[model samples]
Target: MALPTNHSLLLPALLKGSKTSINPSFTISPKSPLTISETFSRLKKQRKVGFIPYITAGDPDLCTTEKALRLLSSCGADLIEVGLPYPDPILDGPVIQASTIRALTNGVNFQAIISMLGKVVPELSCPIILFSYYNQIMKINQESFMSALNYGGIQGLIVPDLPFEDIGSLKKRANKKNIDLVLLAAPTTSNYRLKAIVDASDGFLYLVSTTGVTGARSNLNSQVQFRLEELKKETSKPIAVGFGISKPEHVKQLSIWGANGVIVGSAIVKLLGESKSSEEGLRLVETFTKSLTSALP
Candidate 1:
């Protein structure tokens, strides 16, 4: 019996004769698509918790912000969240609030941040996530904002004021540009609200560790562990606990409670404010980042 005329009988014979017989000239390689969720999950599986260091862009100066980010990357930061200074940052605490004010006073605006990122993105090793409010994003026009973000090499976005109900347009735009729109889940969120947020969020979920504004707390809220446990039961996506995660012990506890990453913001911002010089500021950031990374289980 012979194979059908339409079938390539010679191809199967060639493939069986030698491993590379199919096509010696061409390589058969598989390319895997990278997604934000997959990247965060891989970090979680390594038993290495992610260290997300947040800093206000142009706080003190844009040059210092660039230097601090590079230092954080070198010190083991998995992702760096650059806060875009907003006139009213409701979710921020006194430290971040002060930092935002300073950044604004230094003339940091939407265009300035985009320009700074354009200059610094090429040098950063870790993923850069922009932390901004909806008003700022709206001011830039969604299309322009997305275009600038993509060009600036920003991997993800965190808009604290963007509600699930208002996420459709942004989500569509972000998904089109392959940008992850990370949604926040606060301690006060109801189960129904959490489910909605999880469904809409991409990359990793930002689980606010406390009920109030972002800041450094003496201890991790006991409710945080419970909330994380509940969230884990609900969604398979990686949950990065933020908002009040300051100390190494807090990072450890978050890891134990099944958090995929721990974000330290106010603590890092506070350190930057305390350091007298840019070099010293970067060193302090590196030291603090190392401590947090080392504390992860």
Candidate 2:
């Protein structure tokens, strides 16, 4: 299939422009929260392509995470994916796994991350999306976790390890809390499973660029464009590609491939970890984020 020349056709609802806040009033209530569609709809009106950057909460420390969140929002991130540190992160690559290990060693856990979010989310302009594994969600009572997310002002959730075939209960629970359960689709996904994942995804479909774990790569797979086109036919919902995405060129190419958004994880996480200090780390993230956003079509 030939790609659309007009980028607006990629995801018109996201490119059009409206109010982008998940909840404009800043009310802390998951029961009556803003939908992901509303936030994307607002960005659509502004004709801005979404830029999602991931970070491991408390990797360096909670204070650094706080500063990073503020800097990321001010720089260019449309939505921030905060990775909740877990003991076994099978889906994460070396960069992310190392960051999580650092976070965990520092005594960072889901509850601590939520506490940090509660303080930082109110200050951020973009929505906070908690990324975690299924085991952690199950470890805590589901309802309680939802309540904490609500109280923290989070608008989205992404469980990469949750199989699409078995996400029914988790999806339902997140829906009840008015939180978007963002699902992932991989290059290796079957037609049947791809359709299910696309339909179930709330905020945007996270299309993994390759079959392997998440990490930065110099070149995205050659089949990425074809795979994105195939996923597009499955659903009109916003599609954001992740895994192996790093440089501005990757963002540009993916945008041309009809991606509504781009998710950069390892690259950002590595930058944060490599920084000499909190201020330097925030600056590194800020500069890199700006470059990625500027590359969006």
Candidate 3:
């Protein structure tokens, strides 16, 4: 099935530019939470797995990053993950690490990143999730970070480095704002830890397909299927598998394994790096985004 047109879901204020400000005193609807399972179900009915592509914010430059995001959303993304540039991104592979370095070099700090998003969010069709390390969040006052994210129209957050034991304060803040806080469950995670992480997670459970950093791999681990099965039995929330998922075949396999979503990052960023200009980069990403998403089922 073809993806739904944005006309049905685009915010009215976005169309007229009349709603320039997000009402600070406004309250979120209790039913407005964007859950992983809900997103997966919506995609499943369309015979597709959610395509969540990640790109470092301000990579190359903020303009390119924004263009890439708009392009991805226009082409076929169900959701977009904007990686906050961090100095020490341990979980990221060389490609992402280099992208982060470039972004930081271009003066992409937390405030700048959020400010950019505030300008672009009103125009976006797909939901935007901020992917960052805990330290980046810690550097700013917690309340301030949450306020900025809310103001920027962020739907969710993913902090790969945050441990289950250390999520209380963050969870409370996220819950208060009605923003989903997605937690990652790695292959190395024990069952006890998995339950804890899932219990704390609000939007969806991000299952890292491997034990290490994020990068493209020749093949996915066969064990990822079993892991998905186990996780399915534990929670009704959608399970999105990332880490080393770089190819169309991986996406197909993930769907067959009952995964609700597939996240492709390094491969997409690598393509962007190869393009000569931001416009060319966006075109390339759009083409690939449609191709990979079309192969999901």
Candidate 4:
């Protein structure tokens, strides 16, 4: 199958030092915020915990990924994480690693992934947050890289391996393009370091549930509640919990614990990769996503 490529996917000639977003499709003012921040802010007003689903782009195939994105938007995902496939391990667990391998094997490259996003993002009801590693963008001109993503309708970015000290500059560049450079904080993060992450993180902070890689587990650690409470006390920014959360009950538990958003990744990736057919996979995604949202209040 030929992957969808949008010719309009040119590297956008975006203006620099401008707080406005670079998407030609929309006129954004300098003070206008990225969609992810806005979404979280809205959810905060409604006193609801947002449901964010993660999927490896071009996994199994780009077509399936596109269909999945569309379905997820309509099914109740407040925001979607479109993971850019990388060959090396950057803390991805078994399920996501396998999905990444499948995507790479299918010849899924950055251009193809951006093309698909450019074509489908306008149709999505929710914002897209591209999850990637630092090296992927390090190879290119940082401004141009951010410009490409902004043109494709990516509202946020998550580079898991980027160091805390190096984050300031990157965050500034992404901010100029109207992209939220979300940072991650783990269970082991020191209070001082945690405070820095909170201040630098653009839209929201990704709070890792466990110390290990991203995957589904039988139970969420009891300490996660305490962690959420501690982090919430620190900032008004949204905190989305990821890793080890696989079921609706878990989501219910997190919502009760005062989480602003919950990210279900490996469970959903595992479902899509193990399904016998694309239709079956999407059916499962729809049901599971709805159930997850139902748990959010």
Per-model TM-score, in order, reads 0.86, 0.87, 0.87, 0.90
Pairs that collide in candidate 4 are none
lDDT of 3 at 234: 83
Instruction: List runs of model 4 lying over 4 Å from the truth.
Output: 1-34
- Tens-digit per-residue lDDT, 1-297, candidate 3: 221233212223322223243334533212223444566678867867788999889878988888887788778777889899899999999999988998888887765676567667666667788998987777664555665677667888898888788888998887777678998988778899889888878777889999889999999998888888888898877788999988888898899999888999998887776568877777778778777888876
Q: Candidate 1, which segments miss by more than 4 Å at Cα?
A: 1-35
Q: Cα lDDT for residue 10, model 2?
A: 27
Per-residue C-alpha lDDT of model 4 across residues 45-90, encoded as one tens digit per residue: 8899999999999878999999999999889888999999999856
Candidate 3 lDDT score at position 114: 65
After TM-score superposition, the amount by which residue 97's alpha carbon in candidate 3 deviates from its true location, in angstroms, is 0.4
Residues 1-297, candidate 1, lDDT per residue (tens digit)? 322332222233332223232322222111113345666766867867777889999887888988887788778777889999887999999999999898888777665566567556666667788998998776556755665676556888999988789899998887777789999988788988889898888888899888879999998888888888888888888888898888888898888888888899999998886578877877787788888889986
The TM-score ranking, best first, is 4, 2, 3, 1
Distance (Å) between predicted and true CA of 27, model 1? 30
Q: How many Å off is the CA of 170 in candidate 3?
A: 0.5
lDDT of 3 at 67: 81
- lDDT-better candidate, 3 vs 4: 4
Task: Give the Å shift of residue 102 in candidate 2.
Answer: 0.7
